[model samples]
Target: MIRCSAQTLVALFILTNITATICCPQTCSCQSTPNVNVDCDHRSLTAIPPGVQAQTAKLDLSYNKITTLLPEAFNSLSQLKYLHLKNNAISVISSGAFHGLTSLEKLYLNYNDVITLPENVFSSLTRLKYLYLNDNAISMISSKAFTGLSNLYELTISYNEITSLPASVFHNLQNLHRLEMYKNKISSLPVTIFQTLDKLYALDLGGNNLTTFPFGIFNGLNNLNVLMLMRNKISSVPIEALRSLPSLQHLHMFNNLLTNVSALKDLQNLKTLKLDGNCIQVLQDGVFERLTKLRILYLQRCCIETVFPSTFRGLSSLLNLYLNNNELKTLPATLFDDVQNLKRLYLRHNELTSLPSNIFTGLPLEDLELDHNKLRHPPVILSLNELHYLSLSHNDLEIIPTTFPIQRLRFGS
Candidate 1:
């Protein structure tokens, strides 16, 4: 009798629903000022709290004691865009735990105890964009774990105990941009493991136990930009495998067992090359001839005793050269000739007893570090106009040259 028309009654029902949705849960603190955000983190919670608003966009439940994710645990949060479950003791996750979270864009399960990812564990999150599972104990992952995450952009699973990966584990993530799995126990990879990841931009596989790469290991990654394979046991590399990465810019292979680097001559777009902590005893001429766009080169701690004069022939744009901590007793006079744009040179902790007078000629050198060497005499530093700071510290110099400008020089131990 109170409602005169059906339209008025429906409008009253909608108003009542809206009022119920904005109400905050009793246990968790909610904010409706900006978007609906719920903060349930660090509550020592053993389970998901009840009465969380259905309109909440962000829900933080990290640092809790929840051990397992039951199925349909978050079924009521259909509007959740970000769910933070990091730093939890979650070791088991039901396959349908996220069945109703269709709108979830980012999921943080890092720093948890998840040991394995069962099949269809995340198939319901079709619109997920970012997934962070780093610092977990995940060692086994089903090939279909990420079956429907087509829109995923970045996936970080670093610092885990994974020893191997299925070849088709990432076959569905066509739009994935970055894949970071560093600090794992992976020793070898399937040859076609990354054949379908054409849109991938950065791949970080450093800090692993990889001994060497199979031929055509990086076949279809033409768009790859940053490749970090440092801290492995790779003694040698197949040149054909490196030749496929035409778009690679940064290559970090430091702290490995590589004694020869003739495989890096074809990286024309390379800008940064880090090869420190190896055993390459000598540098042949034109070794880096094709890397004309290289800016930074790290050859320190390589046990290098001899460097050919034309070793840096094509490095005209080189800015920083680090040859410190080596066994070099001397250097070629024209070693720094091709690197005209060179700014910083590091030759510390070497066996250099003397230097050629014209070694620093026509260089825009700014900072020169020759510390911790056996040099008995200083190099010609009078003609270097751009020289600002020169460190001759910890050397065996019997007499400091009077004609050389000592204003910017540091000669004491």
Candidate 2:
């Protein structure tokens, strides 16, 4: 009888403990989603959980092994904002993958092996801000891939095998900010490729087989700041190609077959200029006459033998000057005449043997790089009191002058 009483007590204790273990899926570690935010990212579950219909704002399901999403995957999630499924095995969505999500802000599906976006996949996401579909096997984006995403800001569709983008792909994304369509088989951009995106800040058209510069294109984009036109067969940029951008800051036109630079003189707000790897042996005398606000200039690996003395006279705000790895033996006497703000001057890997008299006449320079040159003596500057970093080690100099040790400069090879 005592043994039976002890067994009943043990049974009661075990049953009480089992009943105390509550099953809360939302807070349960074994069954909870990746992030427990009101907007959550759920991954690796056999199916979408049930309670996400009321919550979940930003769901990032990238790099998972899910094959299918239920038709009600996001059926009633009213607060959902961003949905990212870039690198997943999601093979199919049952038409209403995002049926009731009206507040979705961004959608990223790049780098997926998906073959197509269902016809009405994004018909309800009205406020999407950014859409990234780069590096995907998506053969085509339904003209409706962005059906109801009226306030979309940026879209990147690069590095894909897309032969052509639908003409009206960006029709309703009127407030779009940036678009990248580089490294695809797109031979020609549709005439209206950038029709609705007036607020775009940067546009890249590099790494294509374009033979002619697309003129009459920037008439719509009046606020573009950075434009990249590298690695194309473009001989020269038309003067009118950029006559509309009054606020352009940086212009990248490298690796093109060009001998003239007059077209770039109209950009008054230009800051950084890169013209390396081109056939520009002699720059226009007033090439940078209008670029007074220029700061960083890179002209490495060009056919420049000697920079014209008056070439950089107007660049008062120029700071970094890179003339390395080029075919140059001497710098013009007036190279540093008016550059009062010159800081980093790079003349490395050139065939220079002697420093010009008054080479650095204008301003406060900190970093001077003259490595890999055949120099036997230090650069003769009238005043290098502000110099900080100096590189002249890999040359024939066995010793430097005691006076060469400026207060802030560091000597190097």
Candidate 3:
């Protein structure tokens, strides 16, 4: 009788199991050294190739002509952690299409033709952290679409046609940190839409059609740091909506219709503020008195014609100030007295015909842009020891100062 050795028998059993579970489809490529990964992307196929290796941890099916995702299509890939399906024509998805992908952490569904998200479509992915759904034609999203994504961290739904969102759409995402919904057609939002997202840090709502906001809409987001509302139609900022955001550092509201910013008196910790491309014609005194830590301020192209002497009183830490493309005819001698730490100052394309000789005094300015203005004579910069680059081009100047030492200077007419 022929007797088999124990080692030979164990090897045979392992080979049998491997043969049953490790079969890469003919249209795809697989690797197993650094963990099983399947690449079936960019194929002209219309459906998912069957019999992918069960040990596959990452699968790429992006840039394909796949149109639909049937139920249980990826049930065999239980160990998958990353799935790339962006840039596909997938418009129809069965209810249980992503039913068994429990280990998936990152799912890319951007640049597709998906229009609606049925409820519980991603309920099985409890461990998902990153979800990308940008650049799609999505206009409707079920309120419970993200029901089981409790561990989700970052979500991107930008560049879509979504006009509105259900109030409880993000109620289950308690651990979410960053939520980007920019470049959409959203007109308004619920007052308490973000009440449950206490851990959120960055909220981007730029490039929308929002005309106003409800008061106290941001009360629960205590840990929020960055808020972007640029490129909207808002004419005023409500003080009550921003009173609760104590940790906010950057506020962007450029390219709007704002005429007043008196609501910014309480944001003491603000670092960067962009309010250009608006219609603010005057800067009142004590308007920004509370912004002691502000570093950069952009007020260009605002049709500004007047600025009080105390308009920049509390901005002691300001480094860069942009006042270009306005209608200012003259500036107060002490206009920059409070911003002694300023390094770069832009006052180009204004209506200033003359400047205060002591305007550039006591400043360590590195770059000063005064081009495209109506200045008849350059400002006295003999006290500016650290002046590096000075631009006085396209102005009405017939005589340029030669006493001050500058590395690069532009004084052409």
Tell me the lDDT of candidate 2.
0.72
lDDT of 2 by residue, 324-410 (tens): 887677777776787888888988888888877687865688888899988888886548777878888688776677876655567
lDDT of 3 at 20: 26
List residue ranges in candidate 1 displaced over 4 A. 1-21, 408-413
Clashes of each: 0, 5, 0
Q: Candidate 3: what lDDT?
A: 0.89
TM-score of 3: 0.93
| TM-scores for candidates 1 onward, in order | 0.94, 0.83, 0.93
| Number of residue pairs clashing in candidate 1, backbone atoms closer than 3 angstroms, sequence gap of 3 or more or interchain | 0
Model 1: per-residue lDDT, tens digit, 1-413?
A: 01111111224546442222355556577776567888889889998887776778999999999999999999988999999999999999987999889899999999999999988899999999999999999999888888999999999999999999998999899999999999999999999888988999999999999999999878889899999999989899998889899899999999999989999999999999999998999899999999999999999999999899999999998999999999999899998889999999999999999999999999998889999999999888787889888888888989976687877655434
* Cα displacement (Å) at residue 351, model 3: 1.2
In model 3, the runs with Cα more than 4 Å from the true position are 1-22, 407-413
Tens-digit per-residue lDDT, 1-413, candidate 3: 11111211225446452222345778887776567788889888788887676678999999999889999889988899999999999998788898779899999999999898889999999999999999988899999999999999999999999999999999999999999999999999999889999999999999999998999789889999999999999998888889999899999999999999999889999999999999999999878989999999999999999999889999999999999999999999989989999999999999999998898799878788999998888789878776777888888987866765544454433
